[model samples]
Target: MTTSEIWQPPSEFAEQCRELYGLTCPPRWGTPRRPEYPSLGPKAWKVMERLGFPPMPWQRYVLDVALEIDPATGLFAYREVGLSVSRQQGKTQQILGVQVHRAMAWARQNIVYAAQTRGMARQRWEDEFLATLDDSSLAGKYRARKSNGHEAIIWRKTRSKMGITANTEKAGHGPPLDLGVIDEAFAHEDDRLEQAFSPAMLTRPMGQLWWASAGGTDKSAWLNKKRAAGREIVERLWAEGVHPRIAYFEWFAPDDLPRDDPATWRMCLPALGFTVTEATIRAELEKLDPGEFDRAYLNRTRKSTPPQDPNVPVAAWQGLADPVSQAGPELAFAVEVSQDRAWSSIALAAAREDGRVHLELVDRRPGTDWVIPAVVRLRELWDPVAVAVAASGSPSASLIDGLIAAGVTAPEDKERPRRGDLVVMRSGDLVEACGQMADAINQGTAVHRDQAELTAAVSGARTRPSGDAWTLDRRRSLADVGPFYAVTLARWALVSRAEAGRDDYDPLDSVY
Candidate 1:
């Protein structure tokens, strides 16, 4: 009847037990009290107890939020945890609680917590997580292990550490992370996404990820893409097939809430602890326009919001595309180079399923370190994907020349199409592409990451008066569209390349 006896018990006895009881309960418990776990359990629990596996107050809520216990392992069994509560739900505090427990309670356990903003590194530790460390009592168990401007953390006696970081490549880079908890994950980059979670999933320890956010759209963000991919994995795993270490949980509404119901708004928030009370919710409620509230609160987005340029009135041209689908050559990417901006863009312009180009992709770069690198990226990364990009400017022209010098095929030059050439208009290309892109999105044809900069840029880009008319500018541009700069230059460069029959040129002439 005991575990030792059960194993030594005859095969006939085991078969009889299985046939008699649906459960695995035997004479091991109730009959006797054994101090140690039955032989079947692994040695990890001893390490877990030493490292800090059992969670505390706020973290208990998170564990309960994702409460699927793995019976076989006696551990919380979830591949991913996604929290979409409104702001100030002690968001970072909840993460800190669990992170500390995971590190202190488990050995070789790695935890990385990141947020979208620059100052979040300290805010999470000093303002949210490490506040517990300073309380004197918790400090006895854990000590503030380290701090740079980028991060600070406490080391548990068990040898596990929590690394706090802001949302940037430098912070998210190369580490053997076991648990990755990202705040405002919608702000992460699409390409650099590997830095965020790849290390965790690929490791033998196999880290789980937690993606938490308030609300945003895929106007232009890497996190937008990540969250989208996360959603797809969660929503369509059965159809998409199984992923080994990926699980997703998003708790939110289908879209914007109804103005008629105050209770419904209260229910959308996860901070049921009265911190985000009815009074605060109402105050926030009073400040929101119906549209903004709908987008921000309900996790919905409006694709065709007007760009900054008032002259570029909401073009009737673009339509919304699918969120989880793809179309061919509907968008062309244009990249731009600058010595000023810290980043470059690869604009994914719009095209349609109906054989018309609608959207554009632009990848931009700032001066210095990004110049040659951006050009190299354009050459290798784009090619077959983008229809074309502007290959003008000193940097771009030389980049193209160097490629030709190294033996590359340049897109054949087309004569500069003037404004009168409405049939083949460049601005028309943008407008038409954007229109189709919008249509594609509305119709469910494209995929984008939900993010602040991209959403703000797209929604904020508008026409402003220049001379007698208006044009898209920064407070009104969709983004500092480096891709547009690249594509636009490429358009002109091809033409100039044909006329000059030379390998080098730089024409900064969007206007004569």
Candidate 2:
């Protein structure tokens, strides 16, 4: 039978199967099987049964299509197989069965399993794969080598060995592979594993590579690319009536589907009734964040967009800007550095005569070399009440020693900061600084000169949880947030210095 004829059960029986097992057989999208072509799927299933881990209906469906033998060439139909499914769907067991079958069926075959890291691959091999094989009926047929960095399971009779390694570009250096499996492929950020394995399997006639994972975030570049390619191939198959060299299977709910509905779960989760239940999924739904639940259980990829600060909306922030705003006599300055350390910003804040706070981005330039001299000049000209730098957990913290050596004095006691002291803002201090800046904008108590860098930073700022509060997440934000963060620290330092009542210097004497 051709691909289309291989998996079409009667409509009534298909509906019954859906109701009974919640198995989305044939997957939501995939290369359909050609039953006329011989396959190793049934034999692999038999091996699984002997190992006391029989294939589920969904697993059988995948194996039947992916393991088909090309009658024209007498080798595997596909050179590669890509399987994307929801978590907790017996993927590991299916993979284990395939690896064991390949080892036992073919003498001297080199099979390899890889995870994101060497340590993770070793852990899975020792804890899951080896443990299961040792408890199986064919336990005595294999010898496991447990030595670190050289772990393998060798079938005694066939002399075929299955090894474990990390998903790195150098992973495939040693020998040619008959079978290579990249498990939990979502964690890989790039195509290094594919680059490593593809050439290693080039000369082996029966060699196959497998990529398996649940959905991942937009940052999962390699997996997302594979998923996009698989989807395109499936669409092509529908239009052209021709099969491709890669076998692709995906089981995922549509973006519009209601996540909490059981019908939606049944559509994507092939092992819903077999190994998982609606009640268990409901519990998971309640426990996991909505985005995480969608990615992990519904197999929906997480979409990402340019960062926007929810705390300070763009319209509200724009309303607080004054193009010609001038700083008041009593001033404070703060420095900030970009997460990549490619750029730095300096900002100042002061108390206005009208009881409002004035904020301004003083200077933002490339590299750290210019920051120390610039800060020293600003201190000499303005005689600001205080200068602040985050004490830890920020790229700007690296400038503290340089600032202190440039005659910017650090407070002997942070709890009792004096005027002219370099205030080392701690985690809690940064959190408070962010909150205070937001409040100043919202309460109409702050004004800025509407600098382009400051506006852009405000537009793209994002935050991460810091204890019970939140601080700027410079690393993850879409744009450079150094300018905005510097302004916030300056405002915070001004208010904190005023509270400490330590400004003994007269502002009228300053050059600026």
Q: Which candidate is the best by lDDT?
A: 2
lDDT of 2 by residue, 45-84 (tens): 8988887878888887678778999999999999999999
What RMSD, rounded to one decimal, does every model reach? 19.0, 17.3
TM-score of every model versus the real structure: 0.45, 0.58
Best by TM-score: 2
Model 1 segments more than 4 A misplaced: 1-76, 146-151, 170-175, 191-193, 237-244, 288-292, 302-304, 307-512
* Total backbone clashes of candidate 2, pairs 3 or more residues apart or in separate chains: 0
Worst 10 residues of 2 by lDDT: 1-10
Tell me the tens digit of each residue's lDDT in model 1 across 216-295. Answer: 65553654565556555543543454433444433344332353366555444545334456676666668987655654
Residue 304 accuracy (lDDT) in model 2: 68
**Candidate 1 lDDT trough over 10 residues, lowest sum:** 25-34
lDDT values for all models: 0.44, 0.84
